[model samples]
Target: MYLTVFYALSFCACWRKMYFYKLNMAVRIMTETLIRNHLSHFEVAIAGCGGLGSNAAVALARSGIGKLFMVDFDRVELSNLNRQYFFYDQIGQYKAHALADNIHRIDKSIGLRTSIVKLDETSVTQLFATVDLVIEAFDQAAEKQMLLETMLVNFPEKPLIMGNGMAGFGKFELIKQQQWDKQVYICGDFTNEISEDNPPLAPRVGIVANMQANLALDLILKMRK
Candidate 1:
């Protein structure tokens, strides 16, 4: 009788464990299916990996962008910690590689490509031609304007999303999206420039970067619909 009782209890325990394991596996598969349905088809290019670029890349990865191409010639510096994503130990490392490494830590399944080369008129168009969206995240106005124009000329059908006037603290209302022409969308305060009075800090810069990422995702979803 005691042997029969022991066998019955062991069977119940094993059955319960099997039931929960299957339940957990089912949940995981459902979650991945939902994410893939929404974000498994888009590719993105980030022009620079500074304050705006690094944060925007992270946002996109978390949002489940299928692939990313990031290019930045500069190395991580101590000053970049004020807003950028690199750690102190990552100082002197190339920004593109470091950003990609950090992003992988967040989602290893994401497709990542990094280029540690400076961009110019000749290289910009070719590098970003295949991407569904081009995010201009350079700190300087000249670079932003140059890349924006080059992209529009080369890939007139593609969308170019950028940020401008995001260098201040507070005044969140001013930081919004402005549609330029047909395929360009600029997100920022659009008035504040990086100066002594308006230094680029983390909060304001992240707000704008996230806005750009959200806008990019929104555009991609709209196209699918």
Candidate 2:
């Protein structure tokens, strides 16, 4: 009887030890997988800190992007609060500066940098030269064309992702991604535009911006491989 009791206690101890050992191994594996899958080494430049830019910046910062370069000349307006990420108190503040603060609030570890300056044809290349990826989030068609042209001419080697045509309701399926050319990817419906009658809303704009952020993250991960 004494021998049987001793053996039973020994088996219980061994089982508990093995169970903990496996749990620790699983935890270590999960940690390593997360580290390996992180895109924390890449820097992205987001031009135009309006709806698309600000939303995408928040997504990327949360996804573990190491650095961000946000550029925008516009100030946050009360109307912009409908789609943009700024708070009510941030009205009249530069979008770039406000966006950087907002992003830091989401992920304080992110290296948030802001340029409260206009990005024209001449300045586009210099502003985005150091970033690993570029996201064009301007609302105006003319500005989008200008930035697209500038990127193709100066930084043709880098990837330029832009969003367009995300302005209405019930057209969720239309909001998709397309590769315009080598090093150029466009996200949105490719048809709709915001106007006096059709104002920019949050849900659709957020969907498109999130898509751009996801695509950018995927591209960064692919580059790593």
Candidate 3:
């Protein structure tokens, strides 16, 4: 009778474990579905497909952003491979198109749109008018200022996330997020502009790029909630 009782207790414990396991799985599936539903409806536009833009676009796509609109007129160069996302073979291709291909490789279901034309104030206004958020990732200060001014003056309601001052190394702690206003957010050291003396390295640029992507996700999810 002792052996019989022992077997019954063991069976009961196994059944209990199985029941809780299935319950946890069901809860996980439900939660994932809820988050996916939220993210799958939001769209973002990334202006300038350089190091920050390329890395951030990939991060956003991996995070399951529903759609992305990318614009850049520059073609990939061998020097860009130091920090940008394009492969060696993609050196001659336009940044926008190459970025789209890379993003699609991560998630084929993500909606992608690309423009090879350069972004000016007018082009910025038109391309990003319908996107839920805009990410400014230009290399030059003038282009960055132009995009920022254009978006703020024209698309006042839309959120803009930008990367700035992510050059050099050993200043990882200096990189941070700054809020210009309700609709404008900037990430990076805020002082380390790329130059002949200070080059854009992958680690710092990637840190800032991912920060922008994370901020974009947080904003979109909170807005939906």
Candidate 4:
């Protein structure tokens, strides 16, 4: 009789576990469906396809962004393999085109427009004018400043996300997100500038990049609601 009772209890426990697992899976599926349905209509432009831009673009693509306009004129180099998301075989390819191809492998349905031209103030305004949002992934301080000014001045209505000071190790807590105004959002430590000694590392760069992607998703979803 004791054996029969133990068997029955064990069966009940297993059944309960299976039931909850199925319930969690159902909820996850529903959430993903909702996100894809909503995000399939929105478009974003990522300026500069280096470490920050490459990582952020992949995150956004996986999140189901409908389209992406990638702009970068630089070619991938062996040194870029340390931080950026590019294979060694793709070293000679333009960053924008290579990134687009990689994003396609992840989600073929995602629309990609690649421009292998350097970005200036006029080009920045022209390329990003129609996109729902713009991401500033430039490495240089001057480029970051240029993009920020152009976006705020030329396209105040659209949202702009940027990464500022993600370099070197430790102090992960220093990485933060700040809203400069109603339209501009910045992410990073805001202190560790990339230089010869303090180079951009994968961990810190990826953190800032994913933060930008997360902010982009949040802003898009909120706007949809």
Q: Give the best candidate by lDDT.
A: 4
User: Can you list the residue pairs that collide in candidate 1?
Assistant: none
lDDT, candidate 3, 1-225, per-residue tens: 999999999999999999988996665433656666788998899899999999999998988889999989999999999999999999899999999999988889999999988899888877888899999999889998998899889988899998889999888889899999779999999888788999999999999999999999878876753
Give each model's clash number: 0, 0, 0, 0
Show the colliding residue pairs in model 3.
none
Tens-digit lDDT string for candidate 4 (35-123) = 87888899989999999999999999999999999999999999999989899999899999899989999999999999988899999
lDDT of 1 at 81: 99
The local distance difference test score of each candidate is 0.89, 0.88, 0.90, 0.92
**Residue pairs in clash, model 2:** none
Give the Cα RMSD of candidate 1. 9.1
What's the lDDT for candidate 2? 0.88
The per-residue C-alpha lDDT of model 4 at residue 21 equals: 88
Off by over 4 Å in 1: 1-35
By lDDT, the candidates rank as 4, 3, 1, 2
- The total of clashing pairs for model 4 equals 0
lDDT, candidate 1, residue 113? 91
Using lDDT as the measure, name the better of candidate 2 and candidate 4: 4
